[model samples]
Target: MSDIHKHIEESQVTLSELMLPSHANFGGKIHGGYILSLMDQIAFACSSKHSKYYCVTASVDTVNFLNPIEVGELVTLKASINYVGKTSMIVGIRVEAENIHTGVKKHCNSSYFTMVAKDDNGNGMEVPGLILDSKIEIRRFLKSASRLASKKHSKFQETNFEVEKYISELKNHNVIVDYKGYK
Candidate 1:
């Protein structure tokens, strides 16, 4: 078996693009679907880069949209691999938005994606696990993992439905939320 990594070793992926009119909602904000679309793509990118294998989103935990973004801005998605299980990977995603005209950027959302590695046969495959090495990264990974573990799927869905629905509505309404500066 390959050694696990607690932190991303190869590299991290940052995806950024301009806010097209099609990506905006009735409120002139970026659509939630657009953000989630990018997040899923970036998550796949990070997973593919690391394992060179096919990966799929098993669950997206705590996708929090604390604010909104406007049109004519740049949406940036940054993803990093934090931890890995036998055939599962825990990814951390942070979505940011920048006003292309003014260069204002905000941290609008954060999410945890669990992916299952698969081979060409579509069966679950083994992947190198993530080994925690540093203190800070370890803390963050542990915190995320704990939240993921402790939060039951049903409860997570019910309690976080507001946030989830907001994201869904963002998709349906094509809402735009700008980023808030990361603390």
Candidate 2:
């Protein structure tokens, strides 16, 4: 294994950018898409560092816009590889915006991105395992990791006939399946 492949055991990518006038929307607030682009880049950096190959976003489970980031604040993007599959890895991202003048910080968004590692041919490729180190990081990772696993299971259930039948039966038994947009 190459030295660059050690990204799984412990890795963190941070991006600091001053609030730019170009990044703001008409209301003078930074757009979610702008933040999302930074998040995506951070996630991909971490993933590529781990796999030492190119990766692409397979899915973004949910993106919550917790708060509006005003202009003139510092936006920081953090991303880490939390879980790995045969050919996919789940990255946990937390976006925080800080007012440097006031020292006030608030979480702007939180999201999980799944990346599919591929060879030059675009076929699925395996990735190494991930190791959790810190207590706080471990706790946060557990929450996101659980969601990642559940997301995969739900996707599988949708594609498999037996799982769909079971879900239907569970629904008949009054189990509520949360409805979400597929696209």
- Candidate 1 TM-score, true structure as reference: 0.77
TM-score of each: 0.77, 0.76
Poorest 10 consecutive residues by lDDT, candidate 2: 1-10
lDDT of 2 by residue, 1-183 (tens): 222234344556788999888999988899778988998999899787777679999888789999999889999988888777777778888999999999999998988898988899998878876555577656765776788668667845644645433455565575666745321
For model 1, the superposed segments whose C-alpha errors exceed 4 Å read: 4-7, 152-183
Q: Once all C-alphas are superposed, what RMSD does model 1 give against the true structure? A: 11.4
**Residue 3 of model 1: what lDDT?**
65
lDDT of 2 at 101: 96
Compared to the true structure, candidate 2 yields what TM-score? 0.76
